[model samples]
Target chain A: MRSSAADRTRPTPLDGLVVLAVLAAAAAIFYFFRPVSGNFLTARIVLDNELVAELPLSDLTEPVTLEVPGVRYPITVEGENGRVRVLHSDCPSQDCVHTGWVSRSGGQIVCLPNRLVITVTGGAAEADAVTG
Target chain B: MTHSVRRLTRCAVLTALALAISVCEGLVPLSVLIPLPGLRLGLANLVTVYALCRLSGRDALGILVSRCLLGAVVGGNLTALAFSLSGGLLALGTMWLLLRVPGLSLFGVCIAGAAAHNTGQILAAMGVLASPAIAIYLAPLLAASVLTGAVTGAASILLVRRVPFDEGKP
Candidate 1:
């Protein structure tokens, strides 16, 4: 069998389409599930359904320490004018730190070891804070 | 019976190669490039791609199944089995899909397969944790997937060039 250019290879347009489709689906999922509010100051830390910590992060200057059973993580709040983030953590995975800054609605930092989560709600903090 | 035996032997050799690469990757600490956790070279995927193109789908699946089971035993990380399972299935499935295209090279197919594998693994993590937030990390994982996919795919391409897949009858 004589090998020819056709036998060797060609560009796969369908493969590119597949990659684009997956990317689009991912973006759609992200957009659909995106939090409604755009305010980053409504960040809250919750364990189970009870509110552990709530911050209006517009004036976040101090680092906060959140401790659960067998785990202690310090959430360092930095940045000014509503662009704050959890700078550091003591978790084994360090996933929370890699989560970068949470400025958008529906963004959160979770430490599975302690079953702890820091959520950034897009909406303004209600006068009466509701626990989820 | 002779044909079956030859296929099994080939599968066994490929499995050994995959396992060796996986073990070698595990032994070394590779945090210098980026500090992202659960990062691996996934060199084993070269064998998976080779089997998918040269052998039957069943043969490719067999390689993956055997590799996953024995790989977990040797690596001693049952937790990793979940990620590998999801990733392998997705990777193989994508490769099979691309195989339908008449002129697609094994290298392109493998690259596509690797990307799908990473996506599947990340999705599995999110599902297991009941946290959709993990989706945010997909960008970095996709970037890594492209790089590793190209490296492994190119290597697999060169390998197929050297060892033609037309010899064995499955």
Candidate 2:
């Protein structure tokens, strides 16, 4: 009797365990690869390397509307000082806000959907990349 | 001699196809609306997912491993290898598990695999950033995974049915 594809059993517990282990291991490896820190306040709205807006830390108190001629991008800067980033955007990808708060110095916020970027400049906040 | 030669030829062909897709897709610039780094379209995954069920496990692994190594070399960036490795392994493992379920077609299996792969990659990125806050991106990524997975899974199902499946014979 030929076995049909429908007779197959679902993945065993070992399979899930293996996948979890792989993810955890990869996380451990990348944790070591990230940079500690270098610069500060590199925060600027740059598109194609052209500075569109110089977003000062003080301006982050409320949502700012950035007009890109044909399109208007609403960038909301949330969170308090020390940790700051574009918390919201009108773009489709929402990648800008997803970048999270970039205050780690040398960290950057890039919104590919809108061709926008917010780069922060600061030095290392911690010694170890894992802890920081 | 013919059998061994055929196996090698098959692997080389699949590897090249996977690499080509990876590079070609990389050229298409599709950035996120947010500034979160390490996000991508994951187009190469379509090939990897297709190979897992259509071909043997070792063959699929061979294609993925070669694609990653050669892709990094070609792109001149070693950093991407980690993401691909983690995502690929997890995706393959998930597909393997789900593929066993009765009536779970390749489309369903691939969709599950895609979701798991994205989760794995995001987890890695979060670790690198050392910020649990990045977990918020999971929602968007999961959404994208469903869409991409469904498309890729459907394509693979077509390919499987059209292409000859003599090796596994299932």
Candidate 3:
């Protein structure tokens, strides 16, 4: 009798355990790396590894649009109360535009083609709670 | 000498198959729905899993490398080669190590491989973009890996069961 590949055992208990462990670890990482919710959030716009603008969202009396310097494609960005997002971009991918809004600390919207990165960093409020 | 030649031929075919699957997967507008950077079903890994189970780890690694290189060209840029290589190597390494464990199934190995692959891509992205803050994106990515890995694992298991590589014959 010739043997076929079906002889392998069904999913063992160990496989289920491994899957659970992977999921748990992922959840824990998501929790650990989660953006902190603070009273004040600052949106930092970086272009090609340089800081182009930093908007203090808390103190922002009105929403502002940013002008990125020396970018190959035109990208429109808007920042308002504790959040920021790309409104539009001439870049073909539209990856940054699709990122929508980022309001929490450590959140980011990246445009790889244009090398534009918008990140939200919260200050003071959640630091002690998050770290300690 | 003939045996080595036969093995090389098999691995080359395997690499081509993997490349084809990856190319087909890319054709789907999955990115439009998910809108997540670098997320995919990772169907190409099925070939790697099948090769690893039936063939040697060396063969699997060879296929993975060649497929990534070719896939990058098919992708229309060299920058993608970095992501594919980083992810493919790490995913293959994780699956290879896991195969040594007792009583583990394709499910565990493939799922773990997927997670490692995503992590490797993010690490490469951080390096290329010089942005550490993007690390937060790993969370959803890791979660997505489990689902994608499960799909890949289940499909490979079927391939392993049904497809006869005809290893031994009278």
Q: Whose DockQ is greatest here?
A: 3
lDDT of 2 by residue, B1-170 (tens): 87677778888998899899878867764454434344455666666655665666777788888988998899887767777777878887877666666555555565577778877777777777666556656655555555566566666656655665477432
Instruction: Give the candidates in order of TM-score, highest first.
Output: 3, 1, 2
Give the better candidate number (2 or 3) by TM-score: 3
- Cα lDDT tens digits for candidate 1, A19-56: 56555655665566553544446667776656766666
Off by over 4 Å in 2: A1-132, B30-41, B165-170
Among incorrect, acceptable, medium and high, the docking class of model 1 is incorrect
- All candidates' lDDT scores? 0.66, 0.62, 0.80
**Per-prediction TM-score to the true structure, in the order listed:** 0.68, 0.56, 0.73
Question: Can you tell me the DockQ of model 3?
Answer: 0.26
The segments of candidate 3 whose C-alpha lies over 4 angstroms from its true place after superposition are A1-9, A42-56, A59-62, A65-79, A83-132
Maximum-lDDT candidate: 3
Q: Candidate 3, clashing residue pairs?
A: none
Q: For candidate 1, what is the total of clashing residue pairs?
A: 1
Q: What is the DockQ of candidate 2?
A: 0.05
lDDT score, candidate 1: 0.66
Candidate 3 lands at a TM-score of 0.73
